[model samples]
Target: MEEKKRSGAARYCTVPSCKNNSVRNEGYSFFSFPKQTDRALIRFTRVNYYLLKWERRNMTLPKVFVDIVAKHPHKVAFYFEDDIWSFQRVDEYSNRVANFFLSEGYQRGDCVALLLESRPEYICLWLGLSKIGVKAALINTNLTGDSLVHSIEVAGSKAVVFGSDFKNALKDIQPKIVNLKKYQFNENIWLSPPLFDDAKDLRTCLKEAAMDAVTEHIAKGNLKDHILYIYTSGTTGLPKAAVITNVRYMVMAVGLNKMVAVQNNDCIYDSLPLYHTAGGIVGTGQALLCGGTVAIRKKFSATNFWKDCVKYRCTIAQYIGETCRYLLAADDKNLVKHNVRAMFGNGLKAQIWKPFAEKFGIKEIFEFYGATESNSNLVNIDSTVGAVGFVPFYARFLYPVSLVQCDEVTGEPLRDVNGRYITCGENEPGVLIGKISTLRAVNQFTGYADKVATEKKILRDVFNEGDMYFNTGDILMYDDFGYFYFKDRTGDTFRWKGENVSTSEIEAVISDIAHLSDAVVYGVEVPGAEGKAGMAAIVDQTRSLDLEQFAEGLRKHLPVYAQPIFIRLMDSVELTGTFKLIKRDLVVEGFNIDIVKDDIFFYDVKTKRFVPLTRELYELIMKGEISCPDNFD
Candidate 1:
């Protein structure tokens, strides 16, 4: 007997009385079962017709989830830690949660604050609230003190429900919440403080309520109604609540599935925090809408990531750039043992893109560029290595996105003699702006709950009078090939020696140096200086910075003014829950050795190496006794 090779094309059945074929396409090889009997043909035809109708219907977020539950009632919907919840089971649980809220006199259109970790219950509550037309303000679990109280109060939340892990944080702000009901989940995990004695136990309430579907309330929901209030990351300032309507979420949920070609058998691994848009909307929503499974974790763990993916049979995964970097740094041999074929999310740097994909065995990288509140959205569907997204000429008319020239110092749009903003040419880095109009529904910017903050993001009279555009506050470059590449944030790009300096560009150079785990570049004000000077905070994994080698690398790769004048060496970098670098404190501290305890070094002109910044040299530089190179002024 001889072994046979698999066929790539359709193979016709050779049975004596059968005329069936098997086809291979889109990574799927399936046999087309014969419909020889009349009953079989009728059943297939009816099912196909219904599926077409369902696809054509205009769906909201809640409707999408409900339809998935109806289609795959017994299919596992969520895998959290050691527990599994089926679609039908989660649906039933959400109904009980909704009933419990209604019993407490909570009416439709009410807003509730959600301060919980990534868990199955957090999702159930969010869905239940949406079913009843109530908005859920997703508070960042890492926030505490004034920031925590401001988030709940600013959203006008009628109630606040938190996980047991956040009990202590909630207790500190309980007295200041004023007239709002407080609730806690998983009370068995930890006891609430005595200060929160009045807080209701949501777990007990759900267990006591009937598992009945709130069909009437769900049916009353409008597609345009507010469903979620996701907050900004607050790296620049205080976090603001961004409104997420049902229609917006629907677009994300369905659009991601279509762009990524998600299937019913797929299981998505989502270790990103649930409070963020990537995890909540793209990760969780895509899975639910496709009738797939979601494997969630308390938080991202580089050591346990591949193990969980293999255990849950995950075919897709979500990531941020920092998470991918951590995975690359980890020494786990099980990295290539999983079944993940695709990875989706934003912030995957150009330098790390190809290596991350190849090492992880991911064939597709669905990188996207968008803000939580902004209307602008772009996705790279073809796995364009370094590009965030592609804006084809045909689709540009519909998106209304443009790149405009910006002033480096003011971080504002540059205007010509007519006071009209100038649009950047191809390959020019500029601020990304999306035209705002009621006619272009997809380009609509609902903005933040804070009306003042909402107005601040709008840039009027750009190309023409009476025209308005939403400022993305991000600098990007558009190439001739119709691909958009991220440059840096507006404030992140600073002026030095009459030229604009991109922190991201410099960070990329620093990241290429061996023994350096991470680097954060920013601008710092110098005494008697015209513009801010470049500075960097670096994490040296080797605990010893070879100044000569590091300086040589920077001098060769970076321009004179782009090179950092000062460097702070640290063991680790502080990051937000979503893996965004926390730069506020570092920027404030600057290179002041008195304020910053970290070891600081200054680039010496004669030695061509970085040396310790003693107090004598620091004062001389401040007093004009020492001059920096390229100080044209």
Candidate 2:
């Protein structure tokens, strides 16, 4: 039979009998957040409808990949650096890994930790492990010492597969986890003898192992079985292992593929870390499940993002957190023209969403909202400016998501006299919750590996006596049109000056006024203050922030209580794998000049200006002598 080919830009319904087209392709107006028309309702109703037909019947991701490989063995699956990985090659490589592990007496229900940079081998190792019902714990590469050991130990990993570049990190915890079978592989070239005495060379073992496919019985798993454990960002505290079942993975991947209208020939430019759900699952799903090519980058470079897209002829791209902001800050001369049509992910603020799309010539920006463990998921089908996602009135019954009033200080869901959780009215900020149901895989929440942590997220007797809902830990407000907008994280909103202040709102305003890519906003406890005081941290290496202009902007844009009292000028702000600001350390340091090496400035309320936080001034503020704006209750 002659080989079949499809254009990268080709568009049509994937289901044979279905005639409905994507909202983007059907000429829907891009001006609004909500669509009430029958056409709009029909278009969104088909989301994941095609995938649902076979999703329950499909076994695992590896099985799906094998099927795709059989159909298109020679198709390019991954473009990593200068190398191109074909589907057949990836399958064979994974088979070798599976065979090696099986030969070493590894069996079903075993956990293996993966500590490697973003690369094709990283995916192959995890996929291969999944072939034998072994779960892969995707560890963040940036972690070291105690954090690294905790992540591995929490997952109960019997073995660890690490890149040669991270041998030192493994070595640091090698004594602590002496029982762990350490397997190492070098990205460049394999060492003759392993550099670490305790570590084994994984490449040599794979080369020695057979490349034949494992038998179906040995490689089978229930769709609900856990295949991967993806850790949370640890922005709030220690990272929690969020369980990623095969069914959950399938739902996430298929949902993105269907909603984005991904084509088989489309190339996705993925610059996110492979450990993250956005990069590992959603981004890779475009090519792995939907069929296409994924261009991988070891690290995200704002300067090279566009250049790489152009280099790989990528038709689609991914972004999360401050990625778009960083790109906007990059020198325009280096941002070469590209053929990217659609960009998807979360955290593109409304302030820069339109400008970033317009400047880069992107046609559609599909912003989505979902967490690693939560079942509540939403996607913006229309390019409504600033809308994270929309749950139209017509689709609310299908989605089963609602916003409930929450205590401003404690972040606990507020209940009425009847002991029932109060649902927020339109335009009211509240904690978003998703009703948990086992009928469909999309509405299920697997939660964390720790049962205690898992239970903390479940709200029993939420609306009824026995019903349960997953607390998203996010504050969201939906407009009258049912267009949901992100407000802040539950714990991130601080009480100040007898009012609740949202850190996200302050950060967005500060980032805009500073003309910077990102800013970190948090509340710090003052010695004499009634509540936590607002603090903003901006990355300004030179300490040349225009204090007068910034103060003026703050006065105009923010109220007295919302305005940050302390500003920390840092050389750079630490970010997580997903580009989320790490505020724990900053919050710990607070505004203490002795502890913080960076320059600190205090907002002079009397003068309506900002001045350096000198020792005398700090003492005066600590002693409650410094005059300030209205005090908190």
Candidate 3:
């Protein structure tokens, strides 16, 4: 295959008065092209070869940021609301943060809890911690009380640095985390409480610290050391802190930057929370790696989303499935006014993929698939609609991912008569697992801070004895073209009538209904029922559900067992900071009309209509008196 031509012009040389252009090759630069014609080609080839070798050997998060600072100190590194920080400014700020921590008796390998919103300070602090060999445990700002305490405690954090925005949340968990030292950002030291007596303004500290602190720390840093602890969303239970090493951060930054073809002049608009991997490592880190500017938003507002993009002159934007859905629901006519050429992130459902692209005028939807802790990554670089990623058969050995048959009820990999896990056939949905190897450290699973939680994510003795793999806990399938499609979460798939029911599949179909804003599908338990029954929480914008039209659409598209039996008309569905639906509460409430205040509807098979589920009908269904056509013993 012929190599693709490089995009755009060469970057200006960083060296003063060099009068040479940095040559771009394979998404990275290799110094400036020499003017000597006699040895130009030979010199170019030699330089490129050595740079590639050096990149593979010495690439690390701190090293990359330092290199960018050296190359383009005046370049804008980040834009947060009304503030803009240049590469040199951020580097100096991070140096001060490292110096302050060192003065506080904090040493390498110490874990410091960071509970801050999506701001320039958050990134600076994280980078500073990495420079000094300290790990920053990124806690979700929305978390409170037990959940907050669990995340910090699990990471074994010695200190907690929090912003003023989280004062209430910090107060609520103060008693629980009394043992840990507290420090408040942007606060007057004298006004802070005794517990937070060490509070000092970041800017003040940066101004006072020596300039060489960052340089000395970076030189002593090792790539193998842990730099971050990102907590999971905890959709099932309490969250777990996934360890992120410098090696992992470097891989994520470089891989995403190269895949997206990020350039120095490009500006990336990011609205997702920094605590999430998509916002931090993949979105912001990609820009930092490529010497591009990152536009950070405090929170996602569909009304102001396009305006912000236009204001920031963003060439690329990051999104999740719900972010696109919310934007599509808004009445913003400025959607087509931005310069965004590509939309990058995961969870872009097949139903919304084309409409979102066309409506927003996006040229490419760079959908990718990977969990925070998982080593396996897949990116759809070919612009294939609805495909999370593609891995050719020839590249399967390098990727090392497998779709294995799973037991529907337990959500465990199914074994054959010989006790070996069965690999799924082509086009069949199964749990995706990645082979773990210590030889290739990038492919190894670093797991969570909690040993029990870490062990739960590993599946052993699969295919061969003494072999291990990391369970992704996600169901996926691939087609003849090797394109992978997301099905549902392992826990979200329920067994009914001897068939597996995917909640995501049902939700996708339900989303096609007119005037429906959102839908969250899940399985609910019914007394005397053989398996869980399908239920959905739907947000209808019209305030009137056309049951006849909805029933007809369901009958035409979905199988009998796949259709939701109970429909709870909710005002809105709760979502996490990253835009993932919170289904645990809805699943617990079920279809009980007495407990749930929302209007409930039951599909009446005999009348072929959805009727109000009153107290009388709910009791009858609970008693197993009402017989539904889809329900089978």
Candidate 4:
């Protein structure tokens, strides 16, 4: 829903849902080590939310086309839970699907909405669309109401393949779907126990269309053809659809295969949602390019993860930091059973890097740094502690990036007239900005209807000329050896539970509770953290706060992903001259809960209420002696 826009300093909370998003300076704003003055006015406006710079992708995804048929046509390429398909078989089936669509008059660049979740058929649909240059609009499963409706309209999808199970959810707007040709998903297979029977049955319905005619159209497909649309989690209020060209897919595939050492026989185990880039780009595209094997799980199951790894004999598994923490907490005996030798993905924290590696016997760890809209990327195959990895050139071709001094009130970065910002010397931390060369800018997107979305991501006039560079929106500290260490993400997004936690989503539920006028939520370091812990800084309505009621209320309404673990109750809220909650101070204070001389309250998950953070409880959490659900089962 729409909310009021606060004036001047008060406007901090006006960017959609801010009360639940921002960090309060009342006594617990997140701490910052800002450099000296002489910068532009930097009052806390919501972190520049939209600026994303996706580096240029390879113009074409590495293709097998006629070559793979000559190479390893007989080897199995796809194995469903119940059925297996060889490369030659998949080649024919996808061709059939591609042919079916073309016979139905489908053309290149047409938008086809995919409502199916993670399954073998979903991948087939994606690959088949790629063969014909059609775009797949991967809709977020969590979207609802107007947001869900708006996503389809904005994408202008020509047709929707809605999962049979989710079709009823869209019944309200089904009749109103304009420019829509058909709504087909699990027409029969998405029913009953799917024993690879759905895909098998789908072959029959497609038989009416002449497969011979489909051939002429498939020949026109190229690496630069398919447009893959990855929708952002609306945790940022409104999600934007990123345009992924076939070239982008190819680049990631090649880069990941080389960096992660994925060979034709290696298995890639992915439990992450295919809707995400980590799943689609790195998992699916990369595997397809290498002609390797990929085993897909229905979804991420903590208890079932390692078992799946061993079950599939997976060599390379993709992971999120939060997931690692959970895996680390699992019974130590289970770690040795898996054949997983290497792990890849981002958000693996520095604190737990070595311990996790040693515990799980993971030999190679490739931590990469890239957003859907990235200008550069670092793939650390060496498993460097917290380092995103190394960029080839352009970025490293120039100088080091690190944190610097800036105006506390207004966060204007200090750059010189030459358009080059001051480097954070050797072994210093600075804002990591990838130099956007003509080549690296290829993967950049022309967003869905938001002009500001495009402009906000560009930082113009660098190098004394009026050239534009997309900002990474992250802080990186450099060391004496030219290695980059991730400092933090410089926006409202904080990591928790292996996912990006939108500060605004957290604040929305928090501010709704009575007596809580404002809430600032962020991820903080929990001892032995695989990722950040959710912490909220809130304003109490009464001297005798009803924290028990507050905890109960949040527990009832919010999902596990959005809840705050530590609650720091402030006497009053503090804002800047511009009314922005200063986080630097509060981040430094953290949630000492009981140690600090404040009326702070900690939520006891087991006790089911708020209790003062006594020193004993704090030590218990730090020592890893406390039995809690902070980690996965």
Best-matching candidate per lDDT: 2
Q: Per-residue lDDT tens digits of candidate 2, residues 1-633?
A: 011112211222221212233322222233532233353355455655644655657667777778888899999999998889999988899899988998888888999999999999899898888888888999977666655787898888999988888887777667798988988887776345355767788887888989999867334667778889998732334467899988788778878777667777789999988998989999887666666789999988887898899889999999874577667766778878789988898877776776687788777777888888989987776566666786767567777899999986557799999999999997799999999988777789998888888988899998999999999888898764456888866666665543446676677778778887668888887764445788998998776679899999776656566789999888987675523236767888898988998889998866888889999999998887774465211
CA shift of 19, model 2, Å: 26
- TM-score for every candidate vs. truth? 0.71, 0.75, 0.71, 0.75
Can you write out model 4's per-residue Cα lDDT over 110-227, one digit (the tens) per residue? 8887776777667767667767777888876555444456667667787777665665446656546744665455635435434221122343545564444244445565544546
TM-score, candidate number 1: 0.71
Candidate achieving higher TM-score, 2 or 3: 2
Candidate 1 error regions (>4 Å): 1-58, 187-195, 234-236, 334-336, 492-633
Where does the lowest 10-residue lDDT sum fall in candidate 2? 1-10
Better of 3 and 4 by TM-score: 4
lDDT, candidate 1, 1-633, per-residue tens: 011113212111221111233222221112332221222234323433433444356446678788888888999999998889999988998888899998888888899999888988888898998888889999877666656787898898999998777887776766787588988786344554333567887887899998888888887877678989998732234467898987667556666676556777899999988988888888888655667799999878888888999999999999876577667766866465889888888777666777677777777788888878877777765566667776654446646799999975445799999999999988899999999976534667888888988988899999999999999888898765456888766655665553446676677678776446488888887764545688999987565778789899777656576789899988898665523236656878988878987889998877888889999988988885775655211
lDDT to native, each model: 0.75, 0.77, 0.73, 0.60
Question: Which order, best to worst by lDDT?
Answer: 2, 1, 3, 4
Candidate 3 lDDT, 1-633, residue by residue in tens: 014323211211211211243333333223432222112233323433433443467656787788888998998889888788999988888887888888878888899999877888889888888888899999877566555787888899998888866777778667787778877775333454333434545545566876565677777776567899987632344567898887677566656666656677788999888988889888788655668898999877788788888888998899876577667766766454888888788877666676677788787677888888987777765456667876655456756899999976446789999888999877899999999987665477888888888898888899899899999888899865466888766665664432346676667678775456588888887754444678888996556878789988777556576678888887876665523236766877888776899888898988988889988898898886885554211
Off by over 4 Å in 2: 1-44, 190-194, 233-236, 492-633
- Predict model 1's lDDT versus the native: 0.75
Off by over 4 Å in 3: 1-58, 187-207, 233-236, 334-336, 492-633
